[model samples]
Target: MQFLEDPVLWIAEWLREVLLGWGASELVTNMTLNFLGAFVVGAMIMVIFILLTWIERKAAARFQDRIGPNRVGPFGLIQPIADAVKMLTKEDTRPKGADVVGYVLAPIVSVFSVLMTWAVVPFTQKWIGADLSVGVMYVAAAGSFGIVAVLLAGWSSNNKYSLIGAFRGVAQLISYEVPLFLSLLVPVFLARSMGVNDIITSQTAVLFAIPWLNIPIRGFFVLAAPLSVVIYFISSLAEVGRAPFDLIEAESELVAGYHVEYSGMKFGLFQAAEFLHSFTFAALMALMFFGGWQGPWVGTNNLTGWLLGGFYFMLKTFFFYMMVMWSRLTFPRIRIDQMMNLNWKFMVPVSLVLLMGMPLIDYGLRGQELWLKYLVLFLFNLIVGLIAFAWAARADRRVKTHTRVRFEGRPVAVMPQAPAAAEDETAG
Candidate 1:
C-alpha cells in the first residue's frame, strides 16, 4: 500500500537496493537518483509550458469573442506543437555588433531561472524537489536570475528599444520585490519558518477559529493576511511582467522589448519563460496562502491520496493562473509611472506595515489560543487594508483635482498646417 501511494519513492528504493547488491557506491546511487528526479521535473515543466500556450490563446480568443486555434487542430490542441515547429525552423538572426556570448545565453538563462523555482514547490505532502531549510530564500535567489537575463538580452542586442525595455523591466522588478519580499515575510512570520514546506505544514492546523461562537472552522493564511496576499499577487504580476503591469513588453513603446533581437527558438525560450514564470508565482501563491495539498479525502499515506492531493494543489494553482489571464484580458496596460507609483507608494507601505505589525500582534497574543491570534491578525489586516485604500483614494482625488485646476485656464493647441504650393500660372 505504501509503495502504491508513492511509486517514485518505491522505485527509487528498489533501484538503490539493486545497485547496492551490485556493489555500487552510495554516492553513485544517490547521484543517479538525483539526476533522474531532475530530468523528470524538467520534462514535466516543458510539457506544462506547451499546454499553457494553448490554454492562454484559447482563453484570450474567447475573451475577445472569437474562435481561437480551431483550424490548427481539434479545438486548437495541436496549435502549440505547430507553433513549436515553426519556431524551430525559423532563421536565427543577430544584429551587427551584438555580443555573441550574452545574446546566446540570455534566453537560456531566462527559462532556466523559472525552472529553478520549481525546485522548492511541493506538489503533494511527500513530493517536493528539495525541502531546504532556507527554501524561501532559495526561491528568491533563483527568481532574481531573470533580472540578469533581461539585462543581458538588452545590452547584448545593441538596440535602443531593447535597452530601454530592459531598464524599465529591471526597475519595475526590483522596486516591486520590496513589497513582494515583505509580503512573503508575513507567511514566514505566521508559520515561524522560512521553509516552503514548513509554511504549508503550518497551514494544516486550524484554518479559522471563532472565539465568540466557540466554533472552529478550517482556515488558510489568506483569511488571516488578506492584505499580504493582495500585495503578493500584485507585486508578483509585475515581477513576472504580466499585464496590466506588463511594461517589459510594451510593444507600442519597445517594439518587442529585450528579446527584440532574438529569433527562432531563442525567442521561443523567452515566451516559454514568461508563461512559466507566471504559473510559478501562481503555484507559490497557492502554497503560501492556500492549503497546499490539503483538502478532504486527501490521504497522506496512499498513492491515490497523493495523486488527489496533487490534483487539489494544481486546481488551486490553475485558479490563480486563470485570474492572471483574466486580468490580462480585462485591463488596459498602465503607464510606467503609474506602475512605479503603485509599487513604491502603495504596495511597499502596506506590505511593510503588515510585515512589521504581524510579529507584534503575534507577540502580544503569546500563549493565547490559536484562534484568538488569527482573529486579531484578520482584524489587523482589515484595518490596514481599509486605511491604505482610503489613503490611495484620497491621493488619487487630490491629483485629479490639482490637474483639473492647472489645465483649466490653459489654451488648447491647434495642429500646425503645412505650407501650400503656389498655383501654377500656366494652369491659370
Candidate 2:
C-alpha cells in the first residue's frame, strides 16, 4: 500500500487542534483550517506570479541575447515588485463613456476565474484545495469564462480597437476550445475518471521502453495520446494570449487589445491573469498527461513525504512552464488567418479523431499483457506522427514551389513597356 502524507495538510490539522483547544467547535475548526489552507495557496500563487515576471523578463532577454533588468536588486529580482508599486501609484484614467460596473469588474473576473480553477489542481499529494469529483469539467467551465472577461473588458472600454481585439479573442477561444476539450478527453478516457486526482493516479504506469535501456517512464497517455498533448499545449498558448498567439493584444494592430483603456493596477491585473493562466495550464497539462506528483514512488514518511512530492510536482510543472516560455521566445507571431486555420483545420480534426479512437484502442488493449499494451500504443502514435510529418513535408514543398514560381515569374526590367510607342500613336 502506498502511504501519502501531506505536510501542509498535517500543519493544517495541527492548527485545527489548536483552534479546538481554544474552544472552537469541530465545524468551526474545519472551516478555519480550510480557509487557512486556501489563503496559503493563494499567497503562494501570488508570490509565484511576482517571481514569474522577473523570470520571464530575464529569460526573454537571454533568448534575445541582451541584458534584462539587472539594475534592480541583484539581477532584477525585485523589479516586478517595483513595477507593482508603480502600477498602484500610477495615474489611472477611466473612459468617459465606460460602463462603470463592467469596466471595474472585468479585471477582477479575469483574475478570479483563473484563481478559482487553481482550487482543483494538485500541487502535491493530498494538497489540493477542493478536489471535485468532476474536476476536469470544473476546470473547463471555469476557464471558459475567461472569454467573458475579455468581452467585458472590450465592451466596457467603448473603444473600437478594444472591441475588435475582444472579438478576435472570442473567435480564437471558441476555435481552440474544440481541440482543447477533445484533447482533455484522451486523458479522461484513459484514466477512466473525470476527477483530476483520479486522472493523476491513473498515470502511474510507464508508457514505453527506452531503446537499449530497460527504463520505464510513467504516463501511458503521453504515448497513447501524444497528439493530444501537443494540441493541448498549443491551445493553452492561445488561451493565455502568449506570443505567436497574442493576436488579442497585437500592438502593431490592436494597440493593446481588450484592456486598452485599463491603466495601472487594473492593467496589471490583466497581465497577472495571463501569466498565472499560462502557468496554471502548464500544471494542468503536466497533471493530465505527465504524472502529477508521481515521481519515484517514495514511500510515505512522516514529514519528508510532502516535501518530496512537492519537489516532483514543481519539477514537472516548471519543466512545462519553461518550455512555454521558450516557445514564446523562439516563435514569431503567426498571421491570424494561419492561426485560425491551424486550429480549425488541423488541430480540431486531429483531436477529434484521437478522441473518438481512444475508447476503441482501450477496448482492444484490455486483457492484454503490459508489454503488448505498450507496443500497441507505441505503434498507433508512431503511425499518426509519421502521417502528420508527411503531410507537413508535402505542404512545405508546395509552398516553396509556389514562392519560387512567383519570384521567377516577375520581370526585373521591361524597358518601361517601351512607353507604348507614343510617337507612332501621335502620327496615326
Candidate 3:
C-alpha cells in the first residue's frame, strides 16, 4: 500500500519540476505534449502498416517474376491508398440467410483487437502506449480475440465453407499456440519477469571485472538457443495462417474461406486486420528473438535510439515476413490431414523436446566449460537433424512407390497425321 500510494502525485510533482525547469506551465502544457507524442506514435504505426502492405505485394510479385503495382505512383507506392478508396466506395453486401448483427460486427471486432494489441508493444524506451507490467500476456490474450471474430464471421455467414474455414483457423491457432508459448517461455524464464521492458533489459551483456571460465554468459535468447528462435518463427507463421500452413483460406477448396460472405469495406477490414496481425506478430518476434530497440553501436538516446532500434527491428521483421511470403509463393498448400499431422507429429514433439532441453542445457552450461557445451549441443542437433532427414527421405520414397502403378497391357501409340502441304505439293 505504501509503495503504490501517491504514484500520480509523484509523477505530477516530477512533471511540475521538469516543466518549471524548461520554463513551461504546470499541468495543461505537459498533458498536451504527452498527448501529441502518443498521437504521433500511433500515426506512425498506422503508416508503417500501409507501407508494409505495399512491400508485401511488391515482394510477392518479384518472387513470381512479375511487375507488381507500377501505375498508381512511383513503383505503384499509392496502390494501397487506391485499394482503400475502392473498397470504401464498393457496394456492401450481406447474404439473405446471414446473421445480420454478427456478420456486420465481426470485421470491426478483429481490427479492433489487432489495434489494441499494439498498445502494449513498446516502440522505444520512452515511447509506448500502456507499458503495463503484463505486457506480453496482454498481447497474447488480445491476439486470441481474432479467433473469436473469425469464428463469429464464419458461423454467422450461414455458409458451410466459411464454417469449415473457421474451424480450421481455430484448430491451427490453438495447436500452434502451444509451441509458441513453449518457445516464448525460454526468453521469459531467462528474463525472470513477464514484462516486455524487463525482457528487453535482460538482453544486456553481463560485465564483471573478474575473468573466469565458469562465469555465466549473458546475451539474447537467440544467442543462447537458436533452436527456440527457429521454433518461435515457425509457430508464429502458423499462428498468422500463412502458407504452407494457410488451410484456413484455401481458395481452391473453401472459396475465400471464413470471409466468404463479407463484402466492401467490411471485407476490406478483415483483410486489413490480417495484414496488421501479421505485422504485429512479426514485430513481437523481432522484439523477443532479436534485440528489441537495442543496436550494436548506438546507445539509448531518445531520437537515435528510437530510430535505429526501430529500423533494426523492422529490418529483422521484414526479413521474416519475406520468408513467409516466399514460402507462400514457392510451396503448395498442405492438405488438411497433412497440416494436422505436422502439428501433432513434428512440431509438437520438436517443441516439447526443445522446451525441456533448453533449460537442461542452460543448467549444464552454467558452470561447465564453454567448448564442452558447444560440442554437445552441436552433436545433438547434427544427429537429430540427420535422422529426421533420413526418415523423411525414406517415407517420401515409400509414398512414391505406393502411388505408382504399372500398366500391364501393351502400349498403343498414335502417330501424327502428315501435313496437308506435303499432300498438296505431291498432287501438284
Best of the candidates, lDDT = 1
Model 3: how far residue 213 lies from native, Å: 22
Q: Across residues 1-428, which tens digit of lDDT does each residue of candidate 1 receive?
A: 26776887888899899988899899999998898888888889999999999999999999999888898878989999999999999999999999999999999999999999988898998889999889888889998999999999999999999999899999988998888888988888888898998998898777464778765565678878999999999888889998998878888888988889999999999999999999999999999999788776677678656888899999999999999899889989999989988888899989888888989999999998877888999999999999999999999899889989999999879754443323444455
**Which runs in model 3 stand beyond 4 Å of their true positions?**
1-43, 206-218, 367-428
Candidate 2 accuracy as lDDT: 0.84
Residue lDDT tens for model 2, 1-428:
12335556556667877999999999998888878777888888988899989989988999999999988798888899898999999888899899999999999999888888889998776778888999999998998789889999999999999999999999888888888888898888888898898998887766565878777677646766777888899998988988889988999999998989999999999999999998899999889988777777544554455676778888888889898999898898988988987887678877776676667776887987656675676577677757866876787689779989989878677566555788778889
What lDDT does candidate 3 reach at residue 332? Answer: 79
State the C-alpha lDDT per candidate: 0.89, 0.84, 0.75
Clashes of each: 4, 0, 0
**How do the residues 288-317 of candidate 3 rate in per-residue lDDT, one tens digit apiece?**
766676665435654466666667767777
Candidates' RMSD to native: 3.0, 4.9, 8.3
TM-score of candidate 1 against the unseen true structure: 0.93
Q: State the TM-score for model 3.
A: 0.78
